[model samples]
Target: MIKKITIVAGISVVLLATACKTKDLKMNAAQKETVSNKKEVVYQVFTRLFGNKNTSNKPWGTFEENGVGKFNDFTDTALQEIKDLGVTYIWYTGVPHHALIRDYTAIGISNDDPDVVKGRAGSPYAVKDYYNVNPDLAVNPANRLQEFEALIARTHQAGLKVIIDIVPNHIARKYEGKNNPKNVTDFGANDDVTVEYKRDNNFYYIPNKHFEVPDTEKALNGEENPLIDGKFEEYPAKWTGNGSRLAKPDRNDWYETVKVNYGIRPDGSKDFPELPAGFDTKSYKEHFDFWKGKDVPDSWKKFKDIALYWTDKGVDGFRYDMAEMVPYEFWSYMNSAIKVKNPNAFLLAEVYNPNEYRNYIRLGKMDYLYDKVETYDKLKDVIRGKSLPDGLSDIQNGMADIEHHMLHFLDNHDEQRLASPEFAGTPEKGKPLMVVSTTISTSPTMIYFGQEVGEAGNENAGFGTHSRTSIFDYVGVPNHQRWMNGGKFDGGQLSQSEKDLRDFYKRLLNFSLKSAALMGKYQEIQTVNRHETQGYDSGIYAFLRWSDTEKLLVVTNFSWLTTSNFEIKIPSYIMQKWNLKDGNYTLTDQLYHKSAIQLQVLNGVGKAHITIAPSESFIYQL
Candidate 1:
């Protein structure tokens, strides 16, 4: 693949020098936590959209109408400022060269038919070239790869790691790996297309079937796609990315890409070697050496070499997309090989099946998986004021065995925004939600670029809709643009309320980064309180986190219309477990330092008379 690593120099820093967002950020009142391991925090930014300056939010606009963020936007000074936000890693989304509707034929890059593309800028997950960076993200499209490498170098210099996406389950239908290594071959170069399935073929094919365009295509209805003649010529049609075998896939399906084969037969039987009976109990080292000399399928070797190639270029890790759809065996082979190259690499995947959680984490050698089904979904219920915290404690208690392997987040590119009407209508609703997400576990926490500033994803970007931020179209984000502040990286245009909300997130995230109690131990005191007394209600939740160096009391009110003032009782069992004696101590709210409560250890049971406002949360450091 095209591997060009360059370090850019002499970028103008006039805008950065004027930005003063981090000048007065001094979080005090909480004791500085010193521990062996601290919690990790992630800042996920859509690379193509983070630095955009255009305000023309016209739906279905062309490139000239809506501007895209360039790599130069993330200058050395900007990265240093971002590092000051207490983030350990930055996930740069939409980094790869994907199949966009734009034409770069002058640079020897072929034009993509608009009939199959998602939007004017296209979907980043539909990768067109695995080796090259997206042309839209570079000032000079011909040197896009160099621009990305410079970004990686700058991030490392700022004391932050970088992560990119790796979509293995599928690729753009018109796949081409530019500047591939001499030893490497392009996907489907010599595949046996006549057969429905083969042990070594890269993709599945249908015998003697010609691929037809979906009837819902705008071009099919005469809206015009210059290169599309309402047909895609394939003697034996390949299966759609979502596993649809029809000659004409439904418009709603993943019709822009084709599925990659990994030795699975048409009947869903594995053609590769499976791990032994007790292999789940084996370590990643053993798993790595197991595939050292074994002959593997072509697809497996291709993906493994692809991952190692990027790591060798200085990328820290990958955020695998739709990992569950790919074979579990392929992950075991791929992830083990990845860890061998860099043992400290952070590998995360999006796996939704609770039943396969253990298998993916243990045998697949994945580091973290999205806790959407159990943690995020159940929390949304509480936000809607529907159910009592039925599964909140269970999610923490049930997954106690593997809680560290889960990543927590309230806003992401694929989910609805906190301020969206379809989701939570107000930014205040996210205040308590962020506390529960960050402090309830020892896992990593992530926030989207505009989440703290309350960017409601209600834009009319083409081909992307509803609640979440648009990944396909080039549209300006109103709220995030205020924080961008004319490329100053300062909240110059934000209202006082917005600034206060951001301050709350800053304290919550910064405290999470340094707290030993957060990463040490967790106990849901709400469960015991539910059975012991009437003070704690369904709208309130309480928990305790402690270690040898720190003791933390956390409580949040989920209701937006009610204020909860009650005495939270720590049961005798917890008192004995924490080695409490009859004494009085002070507990200060780390979030705002607005109140200090009288913590009593009398009668060998701890009690704290606390008052929480609507959508307010506290992390008291004792």
Candidate 2:
């Protein structure tokens, strides 16, 4: 469900790039404006793996063989520590009930057959029940929901908001809601199974077809075939999660789950109300009122109810998976209802169609969308030594108008790690990337739990591959395990290198939260330096962020092997904006306040010479 968005003609188009090179970023002149607001930071932790300490590394091992983290693992002390790192929100991944292979049937939850599941632990996306939490995350197993509720209260008490996943695009192959609210019906419960498409039906049906599993020979399996018993029963094969029409899909297809129908007919015409042409500029309140008295399709009400249900339960927000796969109208309906309930609720989506960015944000009422296709992908190319440092200005300039709505991140559950062999193989490279992403704009920044400690994610789990940590199979994150220090949540066992990395993250993030200029205005000085300043390498970058009370110059070193020392020239126009005089002034690095750079200004122009280490970053306050 990872997508790349490119803005063209004020419309978001799906920009597919096999390599790191993406389309040049662009935005309407009217949309490009400097932002000023409090910076937000989101910390995403895969709930099942965050506190797991098992070191056996056995493939397809039992839950005991590879331990799982409990909701209680996020103790008051741990929450404070994470809050101390400057996080405003915590996205608890894999919280909903999914089809895991573990036998919870004895406790009213059913087991999933390995023949249809991806891993021994199954997938967090293969949701079995929408109203319940994952039982594996609770010590009592039966009290999972209570544990999660308590975690939410604790997180709020720590001054951090909570966000969880709402995979509206699909559900598990064995969808059932044993604990659905009274008067609520199960999916496909009141549907006419004979029809292929129905406005009220929860799923699309292949009336006469029977379900056939993927070929066992091609699928990733355990040491022994866990499906030897051979009975996975499902009548009338439904569409696969990726919209695969085949009764039997390939192993590479998303065969573990089925796609949820959202009133679109087989011919691609929608059965729902379409937003008016100028609705893209409408507010959520307008969108909400438009649907208040209208009778919508059944699937629309179903999802809207699910979202409002969670909102009533005090869940602050949701990170929607594969948002564009579902129709834009559906999001407009569901998200508007959510806003009506909790206007401050955070709604982030994975909408990759760059053309649809505005539609989703305005019409669909999404608060933020992933900026991976531009900022993140560009950063990756620079880190890998494949792209020039003509730099991210164009990308930022392109996205400046909507920069605040573009969520930036170096690593998440779906991407490769910073230190993975397949990506950049050093943690230090993230230092410069983080500085630019956090300081350049008002966009929120997110970091996976072990990213700071440099978790390589090189384990051979059953269904998941290396380069990205296993979300399907239970396993330990070695580097993070060191930082965990066996539930003490202390860095007592961390190596010197890991300790240094964590400290760098702490200082930079804390500064981002506390800085006034970062949220005020942004001006790129990198290109100016490369053209005017002597000894300015193409690999070096610089920018300016300021407010009436504070002005700061930022420099980043992206060189893989070279240490950079250069005379960075501040242009006359920039000097005039800051009202500089012809004199000498001391500019000190925010990260290392005592370290100083002397600036010489003559006739409203300034120049400073400083040496920066490889992969280092500095925020010099003027």
Model 2, runs deviating above 4 Å = 1-36, 216-231
Error of 2 at 111 (Å): 1.2
Kindly state the number of residue pairs that clash in model 2.
Answer: 7
TM-score for each predicted model, relative to the true structure: 0.92, 0.92
What would the TM-score be for candidate 1 when compared with the true structure? 0.92
Stretches of candidate 1 off by over 4 Å are: 1-37, 217-223
Per-candidate RMSD vs. true structure? 9.8, 6.9
Count the clashes in each prediction: 2, 7
